[model samples]
Target chain A: MRNVFGKIINTKMLYEYVSLQRLLFLLSLCLSCLYALAGFTIVATLNYIGEDIYGYLFLIFGICFLLTGISSIKINKKKSVRILIFSLILFLIVFVSTAYPSSVGLQDYGLSASLTYNMIFSIGLIIFGLIGALLSLGALFNFKPLGNQYGAYFLLVVCMLIILYPLVIIIGQVTINGAPGITWEFLTSDVRGLGESGGILPAIVGTLLLMFIMFVIAVPLGIGAAIYLEEYAGGHFMVRVIKMAVSILRGVPSIVFGLFALAFFVPIFGISFLTGGLVLSFYALPMIIRSSAEALKSIPQGLREGSLALGATKWQTIRRVVLPPSLPGIITGVVLGIGEAAGETAPLLFVSTLIIKMPPNLLGMVASLPTHLYTLFGMRGGLGDEVEVAARMQNAWSTALILLTIILILNVVALVIREKFRKEF
Target chain B: MKKKLSKEHIIQGIFLLIASFSIFIIFFIFFFLFKEAIPAFIEVGGDIFSTDFSNELGLGGAIRGSLIVTGGALLIAYPLGIGGGIFLSEVASVWIRRILKPIIEVLAGIPSVVYGFIGAIILVPFLTDSFRMISGFSLLAGGLIIGVMTLPIIISISDDSLKSVPREIKEASLALGATPWQTIKKVTFPAASSGIFAGATLGVGKALGETMAVLMVVSAITRAPDSWFDIFESGPVLTSLIAGHWGEAYGLKVNVLFAAGVFLFIIVSVMSIISEIMQYRIEKKFKGG
Candidate 1:
């Protein structure tokens, strides 16, 4: 690849020419992929053979991990023995855990696999850790060293895969579970209760309304603040203080903000969509202010001077020239804030009062998807059948996916506007 | 020519006035918490801090947990976020940039709740297996999850900062016969440090303020970590403090949760202010701001 940058290098030579970094990165990726595949195969083979065989396989790997400590110690140095001890202890625990009798008295995991999955899941984890330790020791001892970048790439990509596993599962499971329920009827209808398989239409309505109103409350205030700091209140103590305040607001936990809404806002304004919107507006502020300020700052002063030379008023230049250019940045901030607002569950908890029947105008109690999902999963023994709950869960994912999609669209729009301003100007 | 006072100026003034009132809203948040929180302080008594109460309200332990978890998350998140940002800005090919941008978008767009739900279902089990049974839901798991959550913010902002680095500096470094990495390490990174640090502090803030996911993923224990390496032990952060204790406590105890909230607010505010000041100093020093 590097050779391609030079015209002197032959095209055929490119096949033979690979950097040590790239080669090492590739090898690490393959090794990790193989290790993961092997773990998966083990799980599959165990699952296929049933409990008795699975238990024995656990016993084998368990002993392998545990016994390596002593034999290795005898053969190798004290350092190896230490590694052996750690690795031994690690696998022994996994083995002991896997060897434990099934919950609910010697049962085959059929239907509702949360417990079974959680219990059996320990084996894969042990294997991964063991491999990681082994690889680290190998790397430490390797005559041929992988450079830092290669090593970093390997670790980063592997960790990312691990993090994305659940997301992959949710995206898979939800679409499979909820695709059938996403009828026009389901999207537009109302959910009466647990038994009703009615669509989350009302929930969607409530979410959109909440997002729109939150945007309404947040954007102008946030933009004004950005303007104050960026254009008006430059290098002032109060401006600096306000900027600090916005950053602080960024870190204020949503749940506490939820509590804030409950303890403060509801008493002042009463439980309603308005309160949820207000709370969400707080969640939106920091990102909006930060991004908007960045946007305003991005507009070159030369453009302002050019406009002023044409006898444009300062306010006119700001409105016609600066605003046109900064609009994309403002929109980026707005979209990001919307994305944050859409996911908020805690604040809505306080603001929505309790379990809402439906929206009672602007001030009525309502349920958003995150809060509804929280109730379904977090609140035990509350919802309908697994199928129904699964359906609702799917709906929540779809709603989130939909929300994400909109943000994506908005982001593209912002990018276009920014790029247009950057180039066309 | 400047416009005289008119309806539009008045409207704009009103808008600015309302926006400025956001400061009052913040003050209100602090004031309300302080008002509600005094009862709890009175209940706990000022003397409580003079002696360690090994089995008391666990407030001290909760603070320790917050520091450990939030700090741990930053430690792990910082290198990846900052390094990746540098790579994207300086080293990466156009194709890599194209791929990375949307991936980050997906990452940045994913809701914290979904991240929590995923953490609860997948990561908890994965950690339980990977670590020992007892270690899965520990502070390490919480820290790791928060690290992932904070990555997009750090990456995006640091990338912005790095791209903001002057072309002249890079050319100057290369002119001195420095490697690309050397230029990045010595010139670009140092120049961009304040902005990158600001991004990091924001990541820490996100990690600290994160509730639903950390609340679900971490074991809800309120114990001070014995050592820095004892991150694998279950513990509570300040964000988790209210959720962890609010249900059990009544009256002044609930007020105690508010006090914790005040503490959280103070922490978040202080860190952000530090980052901003760092940024200002750097800009003023280097760019002649």
Candidate 2:
């Protein structure tokens, strides 16, 4: 029994257990997998080409199923296993029958029936694939050990794939569409007619300017706070309260930060670059403080003690012994904070000038990459002409690509610093 | 020597002031949100909690929408995240971990606006087509986008928690003739349950605070879903309400949006605090306290 179901099942045994019921189960599984593949192709393309590919795939699956079915009919398998596969196939087929066509208008060739039919069919196929694979694994092998182990592995792999799927799509989409819009002129010129004809020079410049101001403001205060909390505070009550507040602060929505900036900083700084920068700094502070504190905490206690033992004052110890070793960690935090601030749009929505034709000054409003994308997204339908709309979309994609590239670079740098440069205590 | 001692005192004072700046910022955020939000609470009275979007800026629908979308997001994220965590912490080898960890970080770093852009362009139309919804901007789309956005947190935190389970416990389970799968299911999972729960709470907090993606994908209509399970319907969440209405809102409307902001702040803060406490407890537990 274990030999049949185990990882090393011989072809002789594999064919030996192929009862009529087992053949039916194998055929159903193969058909459902094909349905799923067809569904995936159809949904992905939503084109006639997808249908053509589906036909070819179906033919291939059909031949494979036929071959397997012909070669594998020898002995009866467990009735219970046969019953489970039969019911599972029945359930899937039942779902396929009831899967109604989507009511959404399919003006092109009345493709609604095929579209929705394949979609739900593929969904049923996926469910059946999961159940059938498990049942087949158990029926073929000892159910107790290998089936459960591999089944759990299968589910985890699916979860990882699902998580990675969007990332792959987003990057691929942005690069394919946005790459065309990244010409030299597009990089240098100002946006014209809702990002149709012009470039994003001002937005790029403003993003950098905002990052600079944020770096100037957030780093010292964040590092200082981190230093105080990690090296100096000891067991103070205020330290604990401050830490709690920081955690809570980290979770505060960016939109609320926008609201706060609108109410507090805008009145004081008046929608200028400084206000946007300060709001971003406020958005970034918790992260920096937390990360910097983590860095400071990781430095060996002996190093600090060694400095203090040598009669180096507390401040002197931190400035020399403690700071140098943890610099990589602190710098990584700053890079991440900058990356975060660069992509922020909500906090800047109410505060940023958003559509500045020229590069921003420190005292004036800013045009950032994120807000640029937001503005372009918002204006897609409002623009009068199709050309204008399409152009705006092109620019939006380009902006997203640029923004993603910048953030990804920063992330990689941080990753490098942590992996290569960080001092291991 | 005396001058050096006084210099140290001065530096300490300076650092103290800098550290307290965080506390001050937190205070001002609360103060400013209150200052702006209180007017709506007073004028709208108990109607501030009304679920009807059309009823003079009631927040009931938005709150309910927030719950539905966030709940939906949690539904998708929780299982996948824990499973991914298990894969990372237990199943993957050290070399694989080294590669996968950074990739997950990159996933987390992808800006919310980018997620929104993709969702608005791809997922929304797909959902609209598949489900035959009004426009495709529904609780489901918002939930899906936010679910992806929140996956990294849940994955990393759960991975951390699962890894934190003392190896001895798992080893003992193995010694008792339990299979590896059984060890994970029975021993490691039970021990890491609190930490996993904390990761979930943190993920929920993040999903709750998500703005741009939810705003872009969730059709921000000011009405509760017709039924509790009606995720296909478009409804406003608090973050979306504040963001979507900010452009045209005036007078009492502005205060109402601020009130929505206050509501978001309080709820997310509560989630963060709870998760933090639970994590602290887990740390204490593992430390033999």
Local lDDT at A100 for model 1: 62
The runs of at least 3 residues in candidate 2 whose Cα sits more than 4 Å from the true structure, single-residue gaps closed, are: A1-115, A139-143, A422-425
The numbered model that scores best in DockQ is 2
Give lDDT: candidate 1, residue A180: 59
Best by lDDT, which number? 2
Question: Clashing residue pairs in candidate 1, if any?
Answer: A122-B129
Q: For residue B92, what is the lDDT in candidate 2? A: 85
Give Cα-based local distance difference scores for all models.
0.64, 0.80
lDDT digits (tens) for residues A1-425 of candidate 1: 24323522454444233233234323433444554555554442332224445444444444443443343342235534554555565466456656565533211322111234333543554355436434433433222123333444444455444434434554565555445546676566666455245655566677788888877888888887887777665687877778767766777777768777867888877888888888888878777887888889988889988998998665677788888768866886787677767777766754542233444367778677666555544643346666666655555556545444455566676556655655755
Docking class of 2: medium
Best by TM-score: 2
**Decoy 1 TM-score against native:** 0.75
Per-prediction DockQ comes to 0.26, 0.55
Please write out the lDDT profile of model 2 over residues A22-78, one tens digit for every residue: 665556555644454445455554432322233344344444333433433333235
Tens-digit lDDT string for candidate 1 (B165-216): 8899899988987756667778988888878876677777778888877777
